[model samples]
Target chain A: MQITSSLDEIRSIVKAAKKNNLLIGFVPTMGALHEGHLSLIRQARTENDTVVVSIFINPIQFGKNEDFAQYPRMFDTDCELLSKEGVNVVFNPKASEMYPDGFCTTVVPEHLEDKLCGKSRPGHFRGVATVVLKLFNLIQPDSAYFGQKDFQQTVVISRMAADLNLDVNIKVLPTVRDKEELALSSRNAYLSETEKKDARCLYQALIKAKDMVNAGENNAGEIKLEMEKVINNCKSARIDYLSIVNPETLEAVTEVRNGNVVALAVMIGKTRLIDNIILMVLIVCLITLA
Target chain B: MQITSSLDEIRSIVKAAKKNNLLIGFVPTMGALHEGHLSLIRQARTENDTVVVSIFINPIQFGKNEDFAQYPRMFDTDCELLSKEGVNVVFNPKASEMYPDGFCTTVVPEHLEDKLCGKSRPGHFRGVATVVLKLFNLIQPDSAYFGQKDFQQTVVISRMAADLNLDVNIKVLPTVRDKEELALSSRNAYLSETEKKDARCLYQALIKAKDMVNAGENNAGEIKLEMEKVINNCKSARIDYLSIVNPETLEAVTEVRNGNVVALAVMIGKTRLIDNIILMVLIVCLITLA
Candidate 1:
C-alpha cells in the first residue's frame, strides 16, 4: 500500500486511477483504526478497482471541552491493518495540510442538524460535512463507505450528499460490535477495564428499547424511561439521551413504529460511548376479498 | 446543441462525455444572456472538449425584496446564443428540480461573504455557492468559467472552491461591458432606456477611483470621495457601497496599492447594479550582481 501525506500526490494518484477507468472507493477515518474501521475498509476493497483511505482527525468537528487533544493516534498500527486489507492509497495528511491557515468554508445542513446529537454538540455535523466534502472532492470516489456506529453522522452525510447532488454513492455498513455488544469506537480506548464493561450498558439499553417496541409497546416516552433504567443499572454510566426517532429524519417519534431507531449516548467513566439499534417489526395484514 | 431541464439527463450526458475522455468546461448563468455571458461561454468552448452551460435563476440568492420573480429569463434566446457559441449542452433545471422537497444544504464562506454585495444582500453568496457546487457536481467540469462582473461572487466562489478542494479550475474572465461602459447584467432589462444611460456612472466611478489611485492618491477615503462625486453625476444612481479593497480577501484597504479592487453596488431607480475595476501598478526591482 502506498502511504502519502501530500494532497497534490494523492490528487494525481486518484486522477491517474480515474484516467484508467478505475472505480474508486473511499473510506474516511480519523486514524486509531479498530474493527469497525477495518470492516469499512474490507468492504471498500471488495467493491472498487482502487480503494483509498484518508486518516485525518478533523479538528473542526470537536467542541470546546471535547477530547480532541487526547484522542487516540495509533498511525503505525492503523496502517498495518489497512495494508492487510489491501487499501491502494493511504492519505494521511497533517491537520495543517487539510485545513490551511485561511480555510473558512463550511457545509451546513438545515433541519437535519437541529436534533439529537446536534442539540448537544452544535456545529459537529457541519465539520463532518465540510471535511467529508473536501475528501470527496480529492478522491472523487464512485462509492464511499461509512459505519452505522455513528448513526447520525451517516444520516447527516447521506442527507448532505443527496441535497448537494454529489455523484458518489454513500454505503453504510452495520455497526461492528465487541464481545460485550458495545459498539467499537476509537474513543473506547479512554475506558478502563471496568468502564469498558459498563460501556455495554448503551447497547443493552438499545436492546431493551427494541424489545419493548417488538412487544407492541408503542409509547416512545415509556420506551425511553425503560431504556434510562437499563442504563442506570451501571454505576459508571450517565444517560446523555435515549431517543426513539424516525430513522431517516432523526425527528422524535411519539409513537414507536417499524423502522424507528432507538439510539443512546452514555458516559461510562471518562469515555462517552454511543450505540443504537434499528427497531424492526414485521407487519402482517389480512386482506379481505370484496 | 441539446437543451435539457432534467438533472438526470444532464448527469448522464456529462458522464458519457467524461467516459469518452472529453474535458468538460462549465459556464453557470441566470439566462437572459448578453455579451458578458457569451464571453464566458466562448472561453469555455475554446478551452475544453465539451462545454456545458447552466442557466438557472437561483431563487435562494434573492432576498425578500429582491426581484427574483421579475428576473428576466430569455431561455429561447439564451439557448440560441449558446448554440451559436458551440455549446454542447444547456442545463436549465426548474427551481423545484434543483431544490427538491427536502433539500436543505448550504455552503457558507466566513470572512469572504461579510462585505461588499454580501452586506447588502445577506445569504446571497451562500445561495450562490450552494447552487454552484451542485452544478459543479453534476457537470464534473475540468474547468468552470465566470465573468468578473460579479466581483464579490467570484471571490466567494473561488474561496469556497479552494477551501473544499474542488478539482475544477475556476477561470475568471474580464467583465464584458456595453458601448457606454455599463457592465452587462440581466437586471439591465429592468431599467428604462433613460435609466440605462445613467447606469454608466457605475463604470465612470470605477474609472475615477482607478485614476485617483494611479495619480499617487493612496488614501482610500480620498479615492472614495472622488468616486462618489463621479457617481453622483447621474440623477438616478444611488450609491449602495463604494469600497476599495484587496481583490483576494475582499477586505477594505486603508491605502490604495497594486492589485486592489474598487467595487461598487448602485441602485438605479428600482434596479440594482454592481461593478468593479482592479487597480494594477507595475513594480520594477533592480538586481545587481555582487
Candidate 2:
C-alpha cells in the first residue's frame, strides 16, 4: 500500500489511477482504524478495482468541547492494517495540507443534517459534510464506502452528493460489531475494561428491539419502550436516545415501514456507541409481493 | 446547439465530449441573454475547446419585491445567439428538472457574501452559490467563467471554488461595457433610453476613483469620498455605496496595499448596477521600493 502525507501526491496518485480506467473506491476515515473501518475497506475491496483509504482526523469536524485533543492517533498500526488489508493507497495528510491557511468555505447538508446527531452536536455535520466533499474531490472515486454505524452521517453525505451532483456513488454497508454485539467504534478505546464489558448493552438492546420489530410487532413506540428497558438495566450506561426512525428521512416513525430503520445512540461510561437494525424482514416481504 | 430540459442528458453529453478530450468552458446565466452574456460566451470560446451555457431564472435569488415575474425570457433569441457563437451545448433545464418536487438544499458563502450585495439581498449569493455549484457539477467543466460586472459574486464564487477544492478553474473576466461606459447587464432591459444614458456615470465614477488611486492617493476613505462625489453629480444616478477597501479581506482599509480592488454598487434609475476597477498603483509603488 502506498502512503502519502501531501494533497498533491494524493491527487496525482488518484488521477493516474483514474486515467488507467481503474474503479477507485474511497473509504475516508479519521486515523486509528478499528474493526468498523476495516469492514468498510473490505466492502470497498469487493466492489472496486482499487481501494483508497484516507486517514485524516478532520479538524473541522471536532467540536470545541469534543475529544479532539485526546482523540486516538495510532498511525503506525493504521498503516500496517491497511497494508495487510490489501488496500491500494492510504492518504494520511497533515492538518495543514488538508486545510491550507486562509481556507474559509463550508458545505452544509440541509434538513437531513438538522436532526439526530445534528441537534446533539451543532456544526458537527457541517464539518463532516465539508470534509467529506473535499476528500471526495481529492479521491475522485467511482464509489465511497461508509458503515451504517454513523447513520445520520451516511444520510447527510448521500444527500450532499445528490444535491451537489457529485459523480460519486455512496455505498452503505451494515454496521460492524464485536462478538458480544457492541458496535465497533474508535472511541471504544476510551472505555476502561469494566466499561468495555458494560458497553455490550448498547448492541444487546438494539438486537432485542430488532427481534421485537421482526415478531409481527411494528409499533416504533413499542420497540423503543423495549429498548429503553434493556438499556436502563445496564449499570454503566446512560441512555442518550433510543429512536425507531425512518432511516431514509431520519425522522421518528410510528409504524415500522418496509425501509424504516431502528437506530439509537447510548453513552456507556464516557464513550458514545451507536447501533442500527434495518427491518430486513419487511424488505423480504416487499420482494415476495413484487 | 441542442437544448434539453434534463440535467441527466446534459451530463451525458458533457461526459461524452470530455471523453473526446474536449475542454468545457461554462457560463451560467438567467436567460434573457444580451451583449453581456455574449461577451462571456465569446471569451469562453477563446479559452476552451467547447463552451456550455446554462440559462435558468433562479427563483431563490429574487426577494419578494424583486422583478422575478417581470424578468425577461428570450429563449429562441438566446439559443440562436449561442449557435452563432459556436456554443456546443446549452443546458437549459427547466425549474422542475433543476429543482424537483421537494428540493431543500442551499449553499452559503461566508465573509465576502455577507457584504455588499448580500447585505442588500439576503440569501442572494447562497442561491447563486448553490445553483452555480449544481451547474458546475452537471457540466463538469474544465473551467467556469464569470464576468466582473457582478464583482462581489465573482469574489464569493472564486472563494467558494478554492475553499471547496472543486476541480474546476474559475476565470473572472473583465466587464464588457457599451461606448458610454454603462457596464453590460441584462437588467439594462429595465432602463429607458434616457435612463440607460445616465447609467454611464456608474462606470465613470469607478474610473475617476481608479485614476485618483493611480495618482498616489493611499487613503481609502479619501478615495471613496471623491468617488461618491462623481456619482452624486449625475442627474439619474443615486449613490448606493462607493467604498475603497482591501480586495482580498474586504475590510475597510486606512492604508494602501499593493493589490486592492475598488468596488461599488449604485442605483441608476431602477437598475441596481455594480461595478469595480482593480487598481495597480500600489503595486507600482511597492515595486519601486523593492
Candidate 3:
C-alpha cells in the first residue's frame, strides 16, 4: 500500500494501475474513519484490484457557522484503519494541496441542490459536487463507492459524474448504522452521553415513517406530521426537517411509492445527525462502459 | 484511426492507447472547422502520438437567443479537414448522443463567468466549462489544445483544469487571423462582405491600445477611453467592453504593467466579434499555465 499526499504521485499510482490492466475503486471521505467508513472500504476492496481512499474535509462544503473549524481529524488512526482494511492507497491532502489560492471553479447540480439538506445548508451540495468531481478527476477511479447515509449526496454526485461524462462507475452502498439505532457519523462524536441516546430518536422517527409507509399509510403530509411527533416527543431533539421525500428526486411527494426513503435532519443538542431507511430493495445492476 | 460515437468505443480506444504508452492529445471544438481550429489540431498532432478531436457544438454555451439553432455545421467538410490535418480520430457525437435525457448537471467557473463575454452571453461559460470537462474525462488526453483568441475563456478553462486536478495538459495556440487583422473564427462566416471589412476595426482598436501601452503609457483607464473612441467612429459597431485587464486577475487595472492584455469585444452590423493584443512580451512569461 502507498500513502501519498501529492496529487501528482497519487495520479501516477492510479495511472500505473490502469496501464497494468487493473480496475480501480475509490472511497472519498473526510478521514475520521468509523465502522461505517470501513464498510465502504471493504466493498471497494472487494470490487477492484486497487482501492484509493481520500480524506479531505472540504471547507467549501461547510457553511460559515458550521463545524468546519471544529471538524475532527484523526489522520494517524485513520491511516491505520485503512491500512488494516487493505486499502491500496490513501490520499490525505491539506486544504492548500486540494485547493490552491485563487481557485474559483465549482460544480453545481441545479435544482437538486435547492432541496433537503441543501435548503438549510446552502452551498453544501455544491461543495460536495465540486470536491467529488475533483477527487474523481484526480483519482480517475474505474468505480467509486459511496454510502447511502448521505442519500441526496449520492444522487447529486451520481448526476454530476454522469452529466460530466466521467469515465467511472458510481456504486452506492446501503446505509450503515450503530447498534443503538443511531446512524453512524463522524459528528456522532460530538454527542454527549445523553445527547447520544437522544440521537437514536432520529432513527426512531425515520422508522416510524417507514412503518407507516409500509403499512399503506401513504399520505406524505400525514406521515411527516407523525414522524415529527416522534422526534418532538424527545426532550432534547430539535427538528431541522422531518419531511418524507421522493427517494431519487429528493422532492416531497404526497403519495408514498414503492421506492421512497424516509429522509430527515434533526438537531440533537448542538450536533446535527441524519439517517434514512430504504423502503424497497433495488435490483443491483452492473453498468458495462459500452 | 478510430471514429467512435459510443462511450464504450472511445473508452476502449483510450484503454488500448494507455496499454501501448501512447501520448494522447485532445482538441475539443464546436464542429464548423476553420483555419483557427485547424491550428489547434495541428499542434495537438505534433505534441502527442494520438490525437482526438471532439466536434461538439455544445448547446449549453449559447444564450437563449444566440445562434445555436443556426450555427453553421459543415460536418463533411470538417471531417475532410481533420483527416487532412492528420488528426488520428474525430469523436463527432450528435447532441442527442452526448446529452441523453436526464442530463441535469453543470460545471461553472465562479468569478470569471460574470465578466466580458460572460456578461454579454449569460450561461455561456457554464456550458463551455461543462462540455469541456466532459470531453476532458472522455478523451483522458495527455494534453489538450485551445485557441487564445478567446482569452478570457482560455484563462477560465486553465483555472478550471488546474483546480479540478484533471491530468491533461492544456496548451493555448496563438490566435490565427486573416490578412485584414480579423481574428479567424467560424462565426466570421455570418458577416456580410461589408461587415467583414468593418470587423477589421475590432482588431484595429486593440492595436491602438497596444501602441499606447507600448509608448510608456501607464493609465489603463485612459487607454480604454481612447480605444472606445476609435470603436465609436464605426457607426455600425457597438462597443461591448474595452477593458485593460490584468491577464491573470481578469480585473480592471488603473495602471498598465509589464503583464497585461488589452482585450475588447464589439458588435459590427449583426455579427459579434472579439480580439486582443498583449502589450508586454513579458506577460507571456508571467502566465503560469498556457
Q: Which candidate number has the best DockQ?
A: 1
How should the candidates be ordered by TM-score, best one leading? Answer: 1, 3, 2
Across all models, the iRMS values in order are 0.9, 1.7, 1.1
True contacts kept of each: 0.80, 0.57, 0.92
Q: Which model is ahead, 1 or 2, in terms of TM-score?
A: 1
Give the per-residue lDDT digits (tens) of candidate 1, residues B176-222: 98889999988899989999999999988888877777777889999
TM-scores of the candidates, chain A only = 0.97, 0.93, 0.95
Q: What level of docking quality does candidate 2 show? A: medium
TM-score each candidate: 0.97, 0.94, 0.94
Once model 2 is optimally superposed onto the true structure by TM-score, how far is the C-alpha of residue B206 displaced, in angstroms? Answer: 1.2
**lDDT, model 1, position B153:** 89
Model 3 lDDT vs. the true structure? 0.86
Per TM-score, the best of the predicted structures is 1
Compose the digit string of candidate 1's lDDT tens values, residues A1-290.
99999989999999899899899999999999999998998898989999999999999999999988999988999899988899999998888978888888899988877777888888899999999999999889999999998989999899889989999999999999988898899998899998988888888888888788778888999989998999899999987777889988899999888888888888898777888888887687999999
Two-chain DockQ for each candidate model: 0.80, 0.62, 0.76
Error of 2 at A39 (Å): 2.1
| Residue A159 Cα positional deviation in candidate 1, in Å, after optimal superposition | 0.9
Candidate 1, which CAPRI tier? medium
- lDDT over C-alpha atoms for residue B132 of model 3: 89
Q: Say which prediction, candidate 2 or candidate 3, comes out ahead on TM-score.
A: 3
In CAPRI terms, model 3 is classed as medium
